[model samples]
Target: MNVHETEVRARALGLLRSGSKNADVARELSVPVGTIGYWKHLDRAKRGECPGRHDPKCPRCDGRGLDEPAYSYLLGLYLGDGHISHYSAHRVPNLMVTCGESWPGLLDECELAMRTVFPDNSVCQVRRTGCRNVKVYSKHLECLFPQHGPGKKHERAIVLEPWQQAIVDAHPWEFIRGLIHSDGCRITNWTTRLVAGERKRYEYPRYFFSNKSDDIRKLFTDALDSVGVEWTTLARGSDPFNISVARKASVALMDTHVGPKH
Candidate 1:
């Protein structure tokens, strides 16, 4: 049972000994009026009798597990184009992900992801110099996403926990969709072919995903592999590498799984 210390009990007794009202003592101590009232009822202030929540520091978040589909996709985006930060004085961590402004619909998807994880937490948006960002504040985010590291992801190692890995295994398509939507796009490639002794123009569709983090790129490729999709790295052995899935079969598979940022 949650009980109070002798200090609080003595203070409440001393204050009640004076002419101070229950509300006055509550205000002075930054506790609930009912808490002080209960203290007086018991002739002393105690914990279980108080009206405050069990976990005062974080009453809203259990800081426990994660949502399946939402977290898988959100993790993909975090690996692709997200960052986490926290302020001083026992502040909760904030997960901030940015995307190009042209795709306003992505904001809704991101908001859904945040709400999926932190149903009671707040999600906000802001427009930067050239991009848009969706931010969520919660104390449990770091617990779910332990990859929360400093500096660019490319400059550090990005790995997944077992539970997160299981989510990706079950929801590989959603993870790939999120990665492609954030750091990649669908494009129609054009080429010229001879038709009946005449030069004819033909078009084919392909998907491209690019990122600076090698580990993140590997994670994307691994998700694709899980779905039996083929990808090739372009301009290999270079900074800011690119991955393209252009084979007719691979393109068809990707088209079925991932689409334009809507």
Candidate 2:
């Protein structure tokens, strides 16, 4: 390659490392996207960063299009109540989502989302005292869920990656449903009101999502905002750790999409 070509390749690699996709890098450099991929492949080879084996199931590793809606839902579940752990003996990773036995429908939905994301992988449920652990094993769990790391999710920063944010943007309701399924509830509170002369019972429905992580709460509320749902943050003592949606229109929207966890 000529000097100009070499400079363009270097800039493309920098952009890719900075989270720019191949098409974006191509547009910025005024080069074909295929050429950008070629340069990236060559750069990885030059740096000896190629993996010994590649899993085609991993969208990031193999450049396959992900099932964004399913992924968005799964991502919400993950951020809410899911965890990833590696087997010490074999290094294989497992992604587990804790689902309450009370909501068997939610448990089934969680398993379905996992299967949609990893069609070839096996999803199973392990019974716990009051919940079932819906889990799937995959070598590329880390690739799918970059948030997997040491410590609890609330203990660490829970910012979503750019790609993940895109998925959430495209399917905010599904994402909200997943989060609500995992850590939220829909309840009705009633009170007695005097209408003219007679006392009447009035009931109002609300949605509440509770998570200890401030970042996760922000993400949930952000999604709510995107879908024109009004939410308020509730504090426990001095710590703000809950989001509530009680506005009539917002509640109707939630009922249309999420409803109660069957």
lDDT of each: 0.75, 0.84
What's the residue-level lDDT of 254 in candidate 2?
A: 99
Model 1 score (lDDT): 0.75
TM-score of 1: 0.73
Best by TM-score: 2
lDDT of 2 by residue, 1-262 (tens): 7999888888899998888987798898898554665566556546754322244367888776688999999998998899997756323467889988888789879988987998766456766789878877678888889988899989999888898899999999999999999899999988999999999999999999999998899999999999999999889899889899999999999999899997
Stretches > 4 Å off in candidate 2: 1-56, 89-91
Compared with the true structure, what per-residue lDDT tens digits does model 1 show for residues 16-129?
Answer: 768788668878777644455545644521423221112222312454555788878888888888888775522446788997777877877887887687666646565576
Which runs in model 1 stand beyond 4 Å of their true positions? 1-65, 87-90, 236-240
**Clashing residue pairs found in predicted model 2:** none
